[model samples]
Target: MKAAIFFERDGVLNLCETRHGHQVVPLRLEQFKVNPVASVLLHQLKLAGFVLIATTHQPAVARGDLSRNELDLMHMILRRKLPLDDIMLCPHDDASHPCQKPQPGMFLEAAFKWSLDLDRSYIISDKWQDAKAGQVAGCTTVMIRSPWIGDDHHDFVVDDLETAVAKIGLLQNNLYGREVAMA
Candidate 1:
């Protein structure tokens, strides 16, 4: 079984903005600012042979805050900058959409498409919903702590992507070494 890595786009790969006192996902290409450490960590993970998949909840598309084309443009920019193998997005609100995060729909879809071993995969995100979804899907979940989301059901919590990546690297190395020893 091959291991994979899943990431949440908003707040993990890019900056999330607040509108009208409510936190909102980046809805436009201009608003899609890549986190400084995200690119470097992604490159490192790719070099380490981890399949990088982006799983995101883009409710803004369903809410008309952004068009599908705009979302595509933002992803294109991200793909150009980061070493991502695939991107799966759920463009539905949690109340109305069963596929949104905390549901594991996006992660299941990506796992099916990529033929990944969900048990051997890892998910890194800055949201509770993201971590919950990953955990439900049987992946090791890491939550990047933020003020908006409180700690609850996460496998691990870190300050930022850089630290998360380092922890993942250590875990991966230990797992791989143990496998080698068993072999």
Candidate 2:
């Protein structure tokens, strides 16, 4: 089985607007802006042989705030810009839904479909719920320091995606008992 890195879509990959301490997902293609730094950072992970998958909880779609077609167009642009292997989404407003964050459903499904070694994998996100799911899913969890990152069980906490990726590199090296430089 191969290792994978799961990323939370909203703040990690793209720029998200904060309104009253809450992230506002882009409802239109014009509002969606991909982060410039993400490309180089993600390229390093991809070249290091980790399958990159994006996991997101877009409840706005379920609430009729965002359309599926618009979301699809955003993801298409995201995929074209980033080296992501797959993008998993939970467009449900129901919290108990299997694929919702704070649940391991999305991670488990990705594991099954991608033949991933969960133990060797890692998850990066700015939310506590994603960390919780990553822990339950048996992957090392790295939380990017943010207001939304609640106090929860996680393997590491870093300031930004670049630092998070470096931390993953260190952990991956330790797991394999070698110092493989992350380019």
Candidate 3:
């Protein structure tokens, strides 16, 4: 099985508007702006043999604020800009919706569908929700410093995506070395 790197969509993979103190995700394709730095940073992880997966919690769709078709268009832009292997999204507001962040459903589902090794996988996000979900899914959690990242149990905290990528690469290499030593 392969290890995957899960990235949060709003802030980590793409740029979002800051509404007051909180970040606001784009509701329409016109408002969407893909982050340029993400391309180079993600390429580093991709070259390291990690499956890049973009994960999101689009509650606006549940509230009838953002349409699924519009979300698809935004995702298309992300795919064109980055080297993502899969895009996993939970378009519901209800707590019962298992795929929502802070719930391990999306990661668990992705692991099952993609034959990923959850223990070896890593999750990168700017929010506490994805970190909590990663914890529950047994994946290493890396948080990028952002106003939205509250007090949470994350494996590593970095100033930028570049630092986070380097951290993950180091961790994966360490794990690989230990496995090789055992063999």
lDDT of 3 at 51: 88
lDDT tens digits, residues 1-183, model 3? 999999999988888878889998899899898887999988988898888999999989999999999999999989999999999999988987889889999999999999999998999899999888999999999899998778868888999888888898788779889999999
Clashing pairs in 2: none
For model 2 the local lDDT of residue 103 reads 94
Candidate 2, 1-183: lDDT as tens digits: 999999999999999989998898899999999989999999999999999999989999999999999999999999999999999999999999999989999999999999999998999999999889988889999999999888779889999999999999888768667534442
Q: In candidate 3, which residue pairs get closer than 3 Å at backbone N, Cα or C atoms, i.e. clash?
A: none
Error of 2 at 84 (Å): 0.5
lDDT of 1 by residue, 1-183 (tens): 567899888888888776775567776678789877788889999998788998887777777888999999989998998999988888886655657878888878877788889998899887778777877899998878776455677888888888899999888889889999999
Cα displacement (Å) at residue 108, model 2? 0.4
Off by over 4 Å in 2: 178-183
Query: lDDT of each structure?
Result: 0.83, 0.93, 0.91
In model 1, pairs of residues that clash are none
Q: Rank the candidates by lDDT, best first.
A: 2, 3, 1
Ranking by TM-score: 2, 3, 1
Cα-based lDDT at residue 34, candidate 1 = 81
Q: TM-score of the candidate numbered 2?
A: 0.95
Candidate closest to the true structure, highest TM-score: 2
Q: Could you tell me how far off, in angstroms, the CA of residue 50 lies in candidate 1 after the best superposition?
A: 1.1
* Pairwise TM-score winner, candidates 1 and 2: 2
